[model samples]
Target: MDQYKLFLQRMGLIGTSTFLVTITGIMLLPILTQNLSIQDYGVWTQFQITITIIPAIAILGLPYTMVRFLSASKSRTEIQEAFYSILFTVIFASIMGAVALYILVVPISHVLFNGNVGVGLILPLTVIMSALQLVFVDYFRASNQMTKYAVFTTLQAYMVVIFALLLVLMGRGVVGAVTGILITQTLISLIMFTFVLKQIGFKIPRFHNLRQYLTFGLPTIPSNASFWVLDASDRYIIGIVLGITSVSYYSAGYTISSLLTILTSPIYTVLLPILSQFYAERKIRETRFLLNYAIKLYLIVAVPAVIGLSILARPLLYILSTPTLANQGYLITPILATGGLFFGLYCIITQIIVMERKTKITGNIWAISAILNIILDVTFGYFLGIIGIAIITLLLYLTAFLITVYYSLNYIRCDFYVKFAKKTIYAAFFMALSLILLNPYGPVNIVLSGLFSFALYIFVLWLLKGIKTDEIKFFTGMIKESLVNVYCALRGL
Candidate 1:
């Protein structure tokens, strides 16, 4: 019980911090649309897609290997050795990746930007910065340093908004925005690297157990790359087939939908090492219990999030984007939200494979799914346009979820709580019905509608026995404790 409370506290800290960052990002969307030209915004989006793909792919998955190995390392010396060795390996990979991007900027620019070479020059720095930052953040997670992790994660979001927005306002366009990100990330990476070295007591990284690290991390390269393809390649297809404005519209909806990750990712960070240790100790019952509880809790939020976002897509987009986008792009939200739901579920279930060290299977599955996603994106996108792209994304995510869950079951089985899911669906249907009837527009209406919908959802869920008494007690206890703490602080303790 104590351990469970500690876990919840840590998750609460991480989740709350990440929620602030997510809200800041959501706030930035309308500002960017209002300031930057659609073409420039499209360019910025493409650059973002590059950084996301590069860091996830270029580091050779060493960050993940670090989490797996460092979690189990016996001695302090072993920990330092594993950390620096993986760190240096990634540093070298980043440099090589930067050089390759610099050399091949021409052809890539041609594909993405109709031969706009300035933006391509920014890739090298962006790639290296992204890689180093990712390594450090994962290092924080592996070391169980949630405070440091939350600060840096939130800092990155703020830095991008401040620097990038200022530059875009100054007429730097895509180049300026990309440069702002590059500069901010480089600075943060340096500071984080210094902190890591101080904590770990820097040692010159060697090849100690390098092969083992690569053995665990290398196969994940394809999986990471494939997941990138599944998520980001649609932007490219939209750019090539429809043009930049359409890409801007598509990406806006995608961004809003991606907010669903705010609920899943923090829990994911908390879950990985815990489950890894559980599996390592052969605590099969505990692992299964955690997995079932996690799925239920995640769905408790995510199911309603999907339904609410779908019902409120238009007004939400209006509030977050330009009028043109609010009109045309609103439809993409529900699709991406649904896709995100599947993707989040996949993230949870795929832990079985990771814990079992059957990562090669993940790579194979995502690879096949990536191919299918690309084919569908290009085919349906060309004929049917952005709407087709949205549908394809949802379908691909569902495909990945089904395939992963099937294989994950083969490895280690756990109950999925079908009864709980049915109750959630029942509650969500009533919420959707209410939202449709309210049909909110503008800010005040949306807020009122949201409050009503939320209360109705909870009331319906409680009536349906979807939310159990014990679950309610658990949350109420936490809330009461929080209020008492606040009161004590106010009274100067």
Candidate 2:
């Protein structure tokens, strides 16, 4: 129980951070969509997708490797060597990636950036800084420094949003937004590097563990690339097939749907390091327990979120973006929300494969799924437009979830709490029905209806006994303890 509480506390910290970031995104979405032209927004979206993919490829999954190996290390010397070795390797690879991006800037600008040479030129530097930022941030995760991790994560989001909004408001447009990102990345990287250096001290690594780290981390590159394909390739396909304007519509919908990730992201962040520690100690039962409960907790939030977001998609999008975007992109939300739910589940379950160090299997699964996703994206995107892309994405996520479940079970069994899931769905159905009857139109009504609907859902779930007393007590206790900690910190200051 104590261990579970500790896990929840850490998760809550990161979860709070993620929630703030999500709110920042929600606030920024309107500002960007309203301020920028649809075509320019599409360019911005393309730039984001490109940066995400490049860093995922360039960092070589070494950050995660650090989490896996360093979670259990107590030796300061050993930690120093592994950290420096991985950091240096990632830096070298990222620079090489930046050079490659610079060399290929012209064609990439044409294909993705809509021939914006300035954004293309800025891309290489952004990729390098972004890659370094990733490594530095994961250093905290590797060391179980959730407070620092959460603070930096939230800080970076706000910084980027503020900088970009200021630049865009000054009539700098998509290029300004891209430049804002580069500036924020560079500053955050420097800050994080300084803090981490102070904590771990500096060491010149012998690269003794470099081979082992690569052996573990390299296979995950395919998985990471495949994931980017599943998640972001649709933008490219839509941009190519329909037009950059259409990409804006698709991306707007995708952004609204990705709210589900706010629930899953913290779980992934907190789960990995702790799970690594448990697996290293051969605590299989604890590992299974944690995984099972994590999925259940995620579903508790996510199941209703999917339904609520789908039901409120139009109003939410209308409030956040233009009416035209709301109308064209609203349908994409339900499909993507459902798909995101499945993908979130896959992320939690696939930890078992990671624990077993069978990263090759994970890579194989995503590699196959990515190929299928692209083929479907081209066919369906051309014929059925963005809706078809959404449907295929849902199918791919579901397939991945099913396949991962199969492979994951071979190593450790986890209960998915089918009855609890049914209750959640039942509660969500009623919430959706209420939302439909109310028919929220504007931002204020939408906010009210959303709050009322969520409260009602909780009430209904409680009546159905889906939420047990002990579970409620546990979370409330954790919250109270967190409040006390905050109060003490403030008092100290």
Candidate 3:
């Protein structure tokens, strides 16, 4: 029961945070669709990628390493020291990056964006603001306060959307939308810095241990860069090889898929700390147990989620996007969802590798998968278009996930792995087949078919002795808890 509570807290806290962030972005999606041209949105996406990839480089992947230490260490001062060290590193790195950007944003933007140099400036500011936001978020999680973390996360995204809408309505154009993002992030960072200072009870950082942060964080740089490549390299390619319209279409697909990770990411956020502590304590059995259980739980929830989105892809796109994006968006949702499942698994396993102190393994896997993705995207996307990217992405991730799972199990031979993988395969195959059988009908009929598939899934699993009675009961309890949370969200509670 105690383990269950901890698991619930970990999942609920981060999951809820991601959920709110997704809701924030999704709510604002239609506004952007209506206001911005496909080319404009494409530029916005390129700007976003620049900001994100910049932090991965500038922060030197410290946020991820910090979480591991924060999770494992018992000393309050140690956590503080680690946090301070990383914060200092981020500060220096951001300064240097900003200078470099100021010098090159114009030329870089001109090349990638067809002589649109203003976006270069927008990208750097976004990076500074976003990097601060990232550090503060890690601060909150290190302090074990998920609620504050969620609030700041949702707040930044909401304010960005609101500012974007206001600017667009007032004829801000694409530049105006970019300004909205900048303003929103700037304000959020100020609030975050203030709160973090207060939370740790330090007026100024007292840590003399920059080496601590550097040693831990530097090794993750390769892994972090590779992940950026795996995920964003296609966007980079599309910008160079394909025109802005193609980039826009690909970005739209990436955006929809991103929703899945936005919700799933916080899982890694909380899990890292918790899992690291377990590993430090040599609680290997508990580590494997939690992972096994998490895999099963994710499938039970995620299978239905991706399928439903795929089924309603058309109407969802029509309702959410303008005529320009309606068809394109629909085609991308399911593929994104498929990619999302594999990405979620990667997130989970990467956390495991971190906990086990296998940084090189993580780095190598991401690098290889990234290279494969690039190859596949170019080779297939040339012929298949966006669908080619999705297919390639989905396949690469699947291969990476299977490799992660295999090595992770070999790292610690445990019985639960076999059991967990069996059940996961059982559920996933069952669910995938269910989606296919339900594919031929109209949307409403498909939904009904999905319902029937779900029932069939449960029945088939039970008949085959895949999941036990108590397991079913536990799942039902979780569903009820989730629904209650949903109710609270609806009532504005």
Candidate 2 Cα misplacement greater than 4 A, ranges:
477-493
Error of 2 at 84 (Å): 0.9
lDDT per residue (tens digit) for residues 371-463 in model 2 = 888899999989999999999989988988999899999999999999999999999989999999999998889989999999888888888
Give the TM-scores of the predictions, in the order they appear: 0.94, 0.97, 0.87
Model 2 clash pairs are: none
> By TM-score, is 1 or 3 better?
1
Quote the lDDT for 289 in model 2. 93
lDDT: worst 10-residue window of model 3: 413-422
Clashing pairs in 1: none
List the global CA lDDT of all models: 0.82, 0.88, 0.71
Candidate 2 global lDDT: 0.88
- Model 1, 1-493: lDDT tens per residue? 5645756666666776667678776777876788877887788888888898888877998998888767656688888888888888898999999999999999998888656799999888889989989899998888777667777887788888899888988988778878888888988898898888788788887787999888888888867675467768889888988898898888878777777878877778878877877788888888888888789888888898898878787888888888898788887889989988888888889889888888998888877877888788888998988999999888888888888898899878877888989999899899999999999998899989988997788788899888877877886676466445433433541
Best by TM-score: 2
Residue lDDT tens for model 3, 346-409 = 7777777676677778677777777787788888878887777777777777777777778877
Compared with the true structure, model 2 gives a TM-score of 0.97
Q: Give the TM-score of candidate 1.
A: 0.94
Winner on lDDT between 1 and 2 is 2
